[model samples]
Target: MTTALWLLLYGGALAWLAPPVLRRMTSQGISPQLGVAAWLATVAATLLAWLAALLMVIGATTDSVLKGNVVTLCLELFGFSEHTPIAGRVGSIALIGVATLTAGLVALRIGRCLSRLRARSHDHARAARIIGKPTAHPDVVVVEADRPAAYCVVGRPNAIIVTSAAIESLDQTQLKAVLAHENAHIAGRHHHILMVLRALAATLPRIPLFATARHSVADLLEMCADDTAARRVGTRPLLAGLSALAGHPAVPDGLAAAGTAVVARAERLVTPTRWYVQWAHRICLTSVITGMLTTPALIQVLCHH
Candidate 1:
């Protein structure tokens, strides 16, 4: 039990330190899609490490109080060796306190985020129906706004919204590119990704990785959508559309920023690196997926060792 407790703690600490490093490593690799996968894997692995530690804390503490010793229960539950020491009461209690605090914070953060998203979604739908008219494209609605802005209304039966200023500002091909990019955002379900990262960051702002992960994931998701749109509508049109929309403010409670992430996306389009995918990037992505999926088995093997 003692070994398991320390192992879980060390695992979580190691996971907590990993996101920024993985962000750098995957950024040097291939697609933004690959980077997104790595970031999601880091989040999954970190959750597993922390949750395992919290459960071990509760299990050991409860068993020690009820059965007068926890080693037997720990051995049966976690497959720790017979020689493994019983968990000390003091450490178990401390871990339980920490776990309880973390869980409470996480719950509160999630509740607040869900409330905000629901309200924003409702407001967006109302605006779309009232001020925006359905377009010939069927999936798009043209909002009669004076600013060169575009963003998707994220919810079930997602809708893409374009301002009248956007229509007056862009040509046919640029409009297609804009629609394609917004569609990519909806098709990729990028808002949900941001919501999870935002919730984690809200709950654990002191953690370096969560802060970095929130920003990094937001950028990667935009890149992924840019890649998708570029492939469909051609990079030149996409780049042109992005350039045209620069300085226009993004919609409130939105996933993509019109001006903020455009420079990097434009540079990526101009560079033309679609054919630069390498075996190294594929291996890294696969390894992250494997590590996250195999964590439980690896923990068991470590206990046996």
Candidate 2:
């Protein structure tokens, strides 16, 4: 009975958690910082769920080994003589089996996603090569696209591709700023992190938390890039670069372009407000903390059986 209950709890948690993470990853046009934060949250939540499941498995195994003894011990400890019903025992076992299967499936899905992503990365690198000269740095690449497009193509040989158009679009200072931002994405390996979170969400689509995390991380990643660019080149030139690129038709989806969030980024740059950005930052932090705090409670609930 305890085993079954443990399984149900863990299985339910996994079922609940998976969807949100997946949704977050697939959602459109999320900023970098928000995306990162959301992904981090999803990871934290998934880890906690995994840990809880592990503990439940341990508990179930122990209970199976000492079924009769455990029931007797429980009776003695609680001064009760009621034996668990046969149906309850069977149900518990079923729950345990289901939970184990769910976890296994999730793990398998994540592995498959990683493998696919690796292949995709190779393909992206090949495509990037078609465009122009490859840079020595693992993250940044100078491409020869006709239009000014500053974007990061994330994969195994994750490359930050910037076009000659981009070079000509902005002054030398703005170009430096643009490169700095792209470099930050590469240096931070932001794409890999986003991919993992997205995979987690795909594996478990029922978890709203994962969705929230994905969107938040996407937005945050952009913000982080913006921050990096702002630091390298003053906010004014960065703003100019962003404005110049905002309406460019060449910018593609899934690539971090110079004009990705031009208006919002510009607004933030011009009227810099710690209150606004920090508010978003706090939302990400709060979500993480809430997940962390709830984990112990979740574990305790599992242990009660």
Q: In lDDT terms, which candidate is top?
A: 1
Off by over 4 Å in 1: 3-7, 14-16, 70-102, 257-259, 274-277, 292-296
Candidate 1: tens digits of C-alpha lDDT, residues 39-63 = 8877776777667667766777767
Leading candidate by TM-score: 1
- At residue 155, what lDDT does model 2 achieve? 57
Model 1: weakest 10-residue lDDT segment is 69-78
Off by over 4 Å in 2: 1-39, 65-93, 134-140, 154-157, 248-255, 274-291, 294-305
| C-alpha RMSD (angstroms) for model 1 | 4.1
lDDT of 2 at 62: 49
Candidate 1 local accuracy as lDDT?
Answer: 0.72
Q: Per-residue CA lDDT of candidate 2, range 1-305, in tens?
A: 34334444554564466446444442332334544544565457556655565665546544754573232212322356665433235555665677678778778998998767656766776677667676655566677667777877665556667777776788977767777777777777777776776776677666665555655566567678778888877787777777766777533324464544566666656766566665675575566547644765665565464
Considering only N, C-alpha and C atoms within 3 Å, which residue pairs clash in candidate 1? none
Report how far off residue 164 is in candidate 1 (Å). Answer: 0.9
